[model samples]
Target: MNARPLPSLNILTGTEVQERLIQARALQAAFKKEWKRLVETIAKTETPFQSIGTHEYAEELAVREVEQETKAIEGKAQRLEEITNGSIASLKKDRQRVGFMRSKSSVLTVGSNLSKDAGLMASLGVWADDFEALWSVQKARAASEALQEQLDKTKEKFKQVGKKYREIKFKNQLLSANIKLVENQCKELEKYRAHETRCKSKTERLEKSKALL
Candidate 1:
């Protein structure tokens, strides 16, 4: 059966991100514990097939059990990797947008200041010889007021972007932590699978020897 599509990270709010991170961490912890238990169980299981009848069956069953568990863990690791990658990509895009907005706000502030200075110059008759001083002052004041309004709006937008950037950064850190945990779990599972392979090979050898006898 086809799996349900994963949710896009870009649409997640801060709370949603936190919730997902928590769930991922809990799953990671549970998987790690289960994996360790499996390894210990496998290690403690006797391998010599002392009772030729039941021991062979038991060995076969244990191998099959471990193989199933390994497959499950591998599947979980793949899903976690996909989630982590999506989160990282979404956060990177948000950071870039915020950075751009901040830069644009700064430019707007500078422009506002220049407009204000022009208004002051016009009021002082700086261009009176070429233009009507009153009209120059009125025009400059209108431009200054418009620029100031735009600057105010830009500043507000900048504040919003800053807030969002901080939130995204925090979520990114949580995702990074989750990714690390999942990666470590995957590595441990890999080691267990390798050990399981050796056990399977040894079991096969023993079976062959028994057949020859």
Candidate 2:
């Protein structure tokens, strides 16, 4: 995008430079709005596997969207910084040209010449603002990534707790089965004890009847 050379500051008057500064400030405002929205989106984003056994795809999609958005913002910040640097360099070069002219020229006109230098200074100020705006966005993205890392850790803990819950549930089921089996065996042992009592009573009765005879 920056392959073409920018027009030198010599041709641009103070009024025209002021116009450019306005545009630059407006661009910075837009960046601020975008940064605010990005922070909001990061805050609203949900993590993958946050829910138990559901919404996996939806959560994953949300995470990917956040990642892509962050990457795009980061790209914009880098590009803006590069452009701002180029603009500052151009301004400096123009100032040098003006200074060299002032040294050789005897007239040393102040009105137009001073306005031109003031305009260049103003231009530099706006570019600095642009640089600052980009820096803020980068910082915000860093903070968002940190928050995401914490969320991931929380999600991992949730998964671990879920696994432990399933393990406990399985153990409880095994304990219930064992208890039922023991109850059934106790019923069978009770039946055998009753049969032994009946046999002892029959043997005693037979012995008494024989004595009577």
Candidate 3:
């Protein structure tokens, strides 16, 4: 037998996730409104019947109406549950995608930096070779003021490049540190969201059980 194909998953961005969450919340609010209306109607109808206790057929019809309303409320609650679960799953997937993107970006940045550094080192090697040739010829005329001036200029150029490299390295370190901090914050937020979801699920289950009772 052929295996069934798994459903394709799309990775949402933070903004898309927020929009989806908002839509889900709106749907939940609408369902809750409908459920509440049904509950209130059932309660109002049953109250008058319980007070008089004389109309047998009316009480029977009221009970049937309440049962229908209860079923509808249950259906709404189930839909809301599905929406909540789906939203959470979407958010989790989004978080994973964001983390992957961040990691990929960091790798790319490091690779680019390494390539640039390698090119700079190669240029510096050429400069060193040139300096070596110049120095060998000039060392014999070390007392000459012109040779001293040329040596000083070469040394200054090397110092400037070294300073620039140090600055770039410092910036890379700072960027990496910021990335790590953001990752930690995201993890903490995810934990909090998961905990909130669990609590909400538990509360929903308790409410369902009470409704059944």
> Which candidate number maximizes lDDT?
2
Model 2, range 81-104, lDDT digits (tens) per residue?
Answer: 666566556656666665665564
Superposed by TM-score, candidate 1 places the C-alpha of residue 136 at a distance from the truth, in angstroms, of 3.6
Best by TM-score: 2
Q: Order the candidates by lDDT, highest first.
A: 2, 1, 3
lDDT for position 42 in model 1? 40
Clashes of 2: 0
The model with the greater TM-score, 1 or 3, is 3
Residue 183, model 3, lDDT: 53
Question: Model 3 off-target regions past 4 Å?
Answer: 1-143
Q: Look at candidate 2 and tell me the lDDT of residue 168.
A: 42
Worst 10 residues of 3 by lDDT: 46-55
Pairs of residues clashing in candidate 3: none
lDDT per residue as tens, model 1, 8-86: 3323444554566578777656554544444344445432112212221533444454445445545655554555555
Write down the worst ten-residue block by lDDT for model 2: 1-10
TM-score of 2: 0.45
